[model samples]
Target: MAACVTQQNPDPSFTLSLSAVDGNLTLVQGEKKNITLHIERHGGFSEAVSLSLEKKGGGGLPSGVSYGFDPSVASGSNSTLSLEVSSGAPVGSYDLQIKGSASSKTQYAYLSLTVQEKPQPGSFSLTVNPSSRSLELPTSGSVTTTTEVGIVRNNFTDAVSLSLESSDGSALPAGISASFSPASSTADKSTLTLSVASTVQANTYSLRVKGTAGGTSKYAPFTLTLTAPPSPPPSGPANATLLRSYQWLQSSPEGDQPAVEAMFYRPRQFKSGVNIPDEEGHGSIDDAGAYQGWDVLTPPNGGKHGSVWQYSKPVFIRLTLNRDARLAVVWRADPSKVPNWLKNNWSEQGSVRIAGSDRRVFVKNFSAGQTVELGSVYDPGASISQNLETYWVLFGEKDGTPSPAPAQLGSPAAEPNKPCPQWVHDQYTTEVTMPNGSKRVLATWHPQVDPVYWCYFGHDHGSDPSLFKAGYKPAFGYIQDDLHTSGVLPEGHPGFKNYVWERDGYRWLFVHHFGTGAIGRVCRQFHSLQVAVANKSTGEIVADLHINTDFGPSTDNNTDLPLDATCPPEVPTPSQVANQSNGERKLHVYDGTQGSLNGYEPWRSDVPGNILGLNLGGLTFDTVNPITACKDPGCSSLMRIGTSTGETRLFAVATDPNGPALSIDASKAAATGEFYTDIYGKKLLSPSDPGAVRQYIKPGLRLEVRNERNTECFARDAFFMFYEGCALAADVPQAFMNIEGALSDKN
Candidate 1:
């Protein structure tokens, strides 16, 4: 049968073949080309076939190059093959294979592609003047810079289209925009304007300025450097100096008080160029044969005591040293050179006490050039940055024997005879030099001993410590004053007007003051305070309390009463009496609407049915209403009230478990309320002033109250105490219900 195999070959079934309509293809980078792909069917092959393009060598398509078929799946004979080469595609020859498959049968077509770089006309070249630019962006508003793009033409006439792009293929950064004047131009030069918004961040950027014409593109490298604007100048004075001088009364051996001595110590640097001439009975000669010692025992008629010595009209001297430095001062008080009156009543012996330490030193037989040295001006183990050295030289009878040598210079004084009480935790000692050069020592155990110290620590636990036992604590507290000013809206702003007083507008101003006098530490300690207002009826939080001040530390000190030596009887006394100088907050009372003249009208007092418009007179306290005094940290229950006039007061009231337990009794209001006393048992409010009242309630207590618009509001006024060894008690104190009407207010 094998020998008889003369059978002719039969036609194959379903044979598929593929071929390109065109021959080898050539394209420029970034160019797209399409060619027809013919699928030949043999022996009536009609089954659906899929088409795909792939590299013949088993590698990815050339970088940035891609290929696709118009009809990826084909039952027809013809299909279009589209090939695209990106501008960044590699310039090289590539071999690709077209694959076609159907019903487990496969066919292939070969393609040769050549990607070439776009041809350059060489007729024109692009050149940008100032290829690199640097600019400082402002904090607000926009800035613009310009550069000229020149086209060096060599027989090129077609208009050139100019454009810009990031060299790294990224979009321009936010806040940056660009424009080209004469966008498509035959002119030699075009202006390229780059605008930078304030919002743009500072950085360096690489960019390309492209000029395209006649299917050719020319690129010019450009660099953009942006820098942040310089910071604004400081608002306060620079290198301002402060000096304090002190005065002391001196008695003579004859019992005549005809002389007074003024003493102050400053850094030795300030002594340069200062000349104290030798005058009979006025100055003493030092070992160098110069009148280098301070004036001693001047007669009362010479000049008023305590007058700070200044090198210039307004310039004073001060020095700051580290805690480890020993503070010392030098002075020679020659009794023989005293004035005639002082000489007649004075003796050779003298007594003196250091200011902060109260360490006494005795002197005898003063010599012409004998310089006395007072030891360290601060106590041992003090943590102060600076010390105040004051010499109280008295010419009266000496009660102690003179030391063999003057007190050792720069040596720490002996421990004081009186030690701090054992119950005083974190018993620290600090020295304060007044604006008048008077020095005082403050200790936590006995802050009341120094007037300046008491102003900061006294009454810190509220008007009465017992009030804290009832579980009632202060929630929020602040001080406010009034400001009279005027301003007009600027052009392009809503409600623009010329010469309009701010007070005449629909909004009212809320001016809050913080820190005053020597209590500038208050500003430093409580730099920022958070406050919240809530709706008492539903216990819902409403608006947040906002004050328009930086709340930074204050530099105001005791400048008005420079020579006053008396300490205040209690807290808030001298501070309230002193001029208000510190931080201030000015806020406008308006609805949250922008650019509307009548925005604040809704909150005005003239508006009817507005809870904020209700007229609240002086607070009329109920004498019989008992209040609980908190004796421990965890007693529960507190009340607060805030008025439209910027006055806030805290209180604790008791009633049945439910039913409007804490609220202002409008029915019991009066034209003038009774005055309330402060923690020191001193009357702080006057009956005649019905606008507001003030009080400090408890330590570490926080209270919350509704805003001026709400009918119900509450607040707690408290101070924070910092004691190293004091820990909060675990047991809540028993409620004392007798202090029902005992409310505290702070204006």
Candidate 2:
């Protein structure tokens, strides 16, 4: 191979080189410097290089001198190194060896480090109070003056010596002297007094305050401005003083009770002759051309009215306080100084302290329901018309009710403490049938409590077993059998309806609530339905069972649509008629028809039916039955007539598509002579066509006529309740109907 060496030179191999960027460096105790090391690949070396440090002669690193690399192992020959020196490090020079190794090849570099002991009081700062000032001097010559200043030490723990000199080339203002109270201090606060003499030039200057502590020094900068004094503000009538006055009336919005409290403000305090507002404020009308703005309250009896109690009258007092000083303006209403009328109406013995500091005021006992005035007379020199600030509080009751006591103000009247008579807590028991054909006695009711009709009105679960124990389940959520036995509807049936129905003998009572629930439980309602077989046929009647307990929003803003989302859309209104024809007329009164077109009527469960009409005598018969049967179509009831006379008229009714109901048919039928019915079932006058009212009678309920045209209806039974329009009205606890023989077969 040695002989063959001439044939080919050994192939070039890759090698790595290491070097120190800042190899030679100097450091002090507690101080450190960064020394970089560079690595290079001479040929094609691409392997990662690892770095470490050691003393040059092969011992461990110097005590307190630590070294580290951001990445101990550098990829592709590159990484940063960090070095630190502790304050306790020995003061000496040392050389460290940095070795970088890659692939079995290693290279070395040197780092020179020197340390020194840490210096005392290494950091310090200074600050001076009243950092700047402006002095006023005469134009001809300077004036002597003195101002108190302060010096503060910051971040300097050791004692500090202070000295002052002109920072700018002003030479301490020619005879101006500056000194600190104690001259030297480690304290945070010290007084600095600066004095300037006459004959010094008026100029702005900055002062340099020096502080030396523990062999270290710092400087604090302060500024001063000196100028000729401004000519005394053109002495005159002290800038037309303006004092505004205010008046507030505390009164109830409805009843005679006055407002419990009223607040007002005083004229804003001014700095001597500065910050004077050119215009009046605090409701002053002084500058307005007409009796407008704050000046409207300027008159002595301006706000007095028959129903108003005057508390104070607007007046202005012209007074002066020593220049550069503040004084109090006390406002007291002495009964001895008030007018007789004011003392009799209001508490004229009260006092209000303005504090004369802040411009705010508050008054209590305003509900005394009386008006007040400041006093009978104004200050000797004060004017009631100009440049005066006036203020007053008045209490009054416009509602005509007597004034409430001061202690009872702002609260409702206490209710009488009479115990409820005819009231007793007692138990009630009844037998009920269960779903499994078992009978049980229910004794959940109070015994001898005040007799009250128990009625459930909203969409809440019913506690009675008949409501849910059969096969029906709640739609909202799982409900316990015991909890569901008390409400009128399942816990969440959605809609607005009140009704009970009997089909094939089985009776079902249902009610719907729209957006109804306890506080925080309000939610949109849901739709529900059920079906079952019914066989019994004995005639039964259901009386007033559900009463209106909740009123909807006073306005129509909250009117919701059909209770069940599956219901049809609303329809247009039907045509009105002056007279009914012999032929059957359509009622157009169902939920999806024109007669119930309004948003409110579409959800009414009480008025849904395909009603037909017929006219007899002066009365019209609008019924769910086209023929003479009241069973097929439910609400076969009589029409209620208005107070109008002679003329016959017909009005359409609101209806729902879910069931059947009745309305009215206005048509002039038989022209036979007058006929009337007494409170009894007897008829007066010649017998006329019974078809007129027969078709409109609601089975057992009857319409008794007082005149020939059935213009008025008389209440005969104890439970008399009917809808006067859409609103329900009750005349007695019971109701009865008188049906003529002719209408007997119509039921």
Candidate 3:
């Protein structure tokens, strides 16, 4: 007995082996065929795994054979491939290299794919970061990620030099290099603080950083971040240059009544009108008198723009007491129709709304002497203890007075008695200690609600193009996987989330809010992980793509794409699929059945076997049947069927986290939480058999393809064959829990 050392280890182990596989190569010029392959784990505690392949020496796998992985295939089951040749493929047998191992293993092996040549897509990364500010630019050798001012290079074309083209079409300082920040930073980060000479066109401009890496160079992403924001000259009623643009609200166009503007506090007299602090917030306005809550300042029902009282020109609403004689203007809300007699200058656009994602220059104007608060409330993701962490910033007059910036939201006078949490990281944030000795946290920022940052980006990844591939994580919440099929994958279903880390391994992609899906291309370095989404409110991924980031436990979370160019399409290997008829028996199998609502069929004649075979090397899936007590209605539109082994797979529509499985419908899947078990004994996906082959077999615990007599129809020709899902090879090592060898790989 090969005392499988890792067979019982808490961590993962690997064993690589390759073998040539075949099924059918029905392809056209520029098209590829998907073939079936198998994989086995020498030792590891994990019962499930995902396998992938890469045509190592880069020319790419043979154009004739497009491959994919399917867990439907037992450890030694078959997955299919498509064969498509390009106009200039070096016809004949070429070695199609493949790589993969069990999800439970830390090792991987190489396999060979044979076929004719054709054009294939490759992948690469170009990243840049660091963005630290120095008093001056360094005068020295090329700046690489290893040092400050990291040089972002073309991950594909390591030889290519970066090109900096500003949005304003201006040139950059010579010798200034661009590169991806170390795993410590993201390419979207400010890598270099460019201070152009006044003589350089000082305008915000579009920027595009280009260069070559690997063997070839193609147009990369248009550097999306703005390089420079326009420096709007300071504006305030105190400055004579700006004072001329105003007309005091207390004074009529015909004359003036200074007393109206001096009810509680006296108003300042500027040359042109009155000098209210543009730097002052409503907080600065004296509130010592009546109108404490602006209760006494409501305008008549009808004001200008349909309000009674409106600002003719200048109306400074301060937050705090601005001066010894000041009347704090809290609301200044216009109610009814304004005196048509008054000429108002403020437009609806001039008013500011404090929603979120408002970190913009426009904020400056609306906030000049605007009502403000001291600090911001940490809209805790939920009403949970230790969830709220309020913070404040430094804003207001430069008088050096002890005042919280903009506004002091919570008891500013007692702020000294309170302290901020230890984890607070704002530069201006502080902690407050109460007399009771309990520590409190107070931090803040002019928050931009739900800021979007990319962890990884790639073009054209999803089965459809509109689906943009993106990976993301929320700043303050856990990602919710709720896509119908995506959210509830059965044990035997072939889906992304269905793939799991072997026992003890805690590894899985955390997608936050990528909207489109996966499509498009940008330069790479698989920089910090990021995801694209449609809307912050919706929280949907655009698409799933091959994204890389500096996370996990190694290299401080830095990850580069594994591509010199867009390497050829990867062909995945076959994996194990379990069958739980009479006993809980498991076996490895291959499956690739990319399906569409149009191709969904419950029978073999409706579709041909292998026709729906997954392109494991590329994008593929299995139509695993659910083994549950679900009460949900089936969608004829999304009805997916499996070419099970004639009749030994469970048909569960629901499951119970603690109770036995139930054979129900969709409606009950989530509501009941029941686990549907299979009493039939059917083997995992295998070639079709005839006659009594399936007589003794029972359905599987999962509703995936079972191997038996009736399965023969789907053996060689089926519209689509469903199987269990496979795991990502890159996410493997991170899945290790305690294996020394597995941990060593990460280190």
Candidate 4:
């Protein structure tokens, strides 16, 4: 403990009183002023206290403010202060802290001081050049653009101080101006030109030069840039005018679709007057006439198959060239059989390869943030009767109920009361397939169901269209076709969306895809019915997934299916089909609700032979949160793990009692190996290592580790990474984890 020392009353509002009579504080700026500090002693007083003045919150010296003591300011008490005004200090008011150190103890005190400005001694001036003007340069020549910067100083007493600096480094002419003529700010009046040199370019340019007022000096920077004219493009094969593939956006109720109609044939590259058509499309095209629908083309009599018309817009190229340069136009029907054929080959009065790929215009609708320019290509060709009905293009963003505008039957009018009248309605029919040979005959507002709804159509995961492989493909597959319409809702098309196709036939499609890692191999005849789903490594069924579920012609048409699957007597009404399962969820053979209720269509595809479909007979998604730990009242399987063809994939789950996760396994060569997922989202298994306790695995990360024989071979198969889920699963980095010693023998 030390003895205490004291001074004037300790109230922050007033300056402390000092007892030392001679000790005084001074305020300094341009002039110094005397300040009277009261001195008052209180209890616990000790030896004489020393005094020193400092900036309110700093040392005795603060830029322009410093303390001057009578006896001289020191670190301890009893010292005097003499305030000195710094010459470089700016005019302003400032707080001065007065510190008193009594013996070894000290306290803080403060006072206010202000500095007044004094007029500077010397005078300075400045002058600018060519206020503003324009300069022109040759389109393809080297030109230097410059701005003349001038700094002038007239009235002066002290050597008018100045410096020449620039905002940017533009080329400047040498000693632009001298004392008498040219100007230089640092010493005397001077002028310099800032310049930008042009290469073989054609563009406008801007440049700015700065001139400083020399008297006291302040930074004044001007900013600008000079650009040379834009140069003409260089000539070369790479720079040559290449034919840009044309695009047409033909949509169904959903969006753009593919089409081929009576576009009068004309040589593609005719730079001269109206290019002539190679062959006029049949005049009855709009009437559903001709090969490649040439007969159905608009104004069938307007021109022949090869009529010529000048058009900057690209017309459809109905002809497709195969690897052998064989021009083909192919068309097909579910025919309920797989085959190797073409549309324009082997004829019987007329009939080429069955379901051959069709050569048509590529129509695409796009959103911003993505390239809108794209060209159509020769996917595949298909053969059809002299009269295959073509479809029209529709845009996705437009709003309106889709009007059924099937091509009007041309020459061959429909027979009275015919199921598919030749001229009655433009709608087409597709097959309602079942395991048995039984098929449901269908009629749709969209004639091109397969092509419109099933084909791959959209901006894809891939970046380049050229990377897409060309081939004949079946239209997208939907589980049920009741009230499903692209115009109403977006159904999952295998390619991207559900398109419209006119048919009792199959549309040969070519996919321009830069397919990546694994893809599920789709196949037909699962239970002898066409099916699609993830497959196991052994090429057997592993999942039963589906596109969308639709009710028969909606309330509008009411063209009921034999049975209403989407809205069955067994199930509840539409209002009851909430996220939860209501009514009796009796897994009926038809799910009770057979009528279409306009629902979603899922996307499923196999490389070649595996079917991608859902188990209409067995649908379950736990909407009441099956797992106590999940925190969600949804199906048990938070993640779906399934096999398709030779691999497994992952699928995000929805919160529905009828959907948890699809089960799959490709273990058998004969068995469809398809199964539903177990309702258990989180799995807690014992850790193999003593260092670890419980093992928590995400449902997605879990794989089929063993086959029926309990062999580990199937789970570790590396080829199965192509499964959709594999790409999304994260690889865990773990340490010190041990495995069962007993299994070591198998190694």
Tell me, by lDDT, which candidate is best. 1
C-alpha TM-score for every candidate: 0.19, 0.18, 0.18, 0.21
| Tens digits of lDDT, candidate 1, 242-347 | 1111222222221211111222221111111121111111121112111111122211212222232211121111222111121222222322222232233333
Ranking of all candidate structures by their lDDT, best first: 1, 2, 4, 3
Off by over 4 Å in 2: 1-343, 353-747
Going through the candidates in the order shown, the clash numbers are: 29, 43, 217, 169
Q: Write the per-residue lDDT of candidate 2 for residues 578-686, one digit (tens) a residue.
A: 1211211222112333333211111121211112111111211111111111111111222211111101111122233332222222222111112222111122222
| Runs off by more than 4 Å, candidate 1 | 1-122, 235-747
For candidate 3, the 10 contiguous residues with the lowest summed lDDT are: 446-455
Compose the digit string of candidate 4's lDDT tens values, residues 419-464. Answer: 2233233233445443333455543222111111111111111111
Candidate 4's TM-score: 0.21
lDDT of 3: 0.22
User: Which parts of model 3 have CA positions greater than 4 angstroms off?
Assistant: 1-159, 167-170, 173-204, 213-216, 222-747
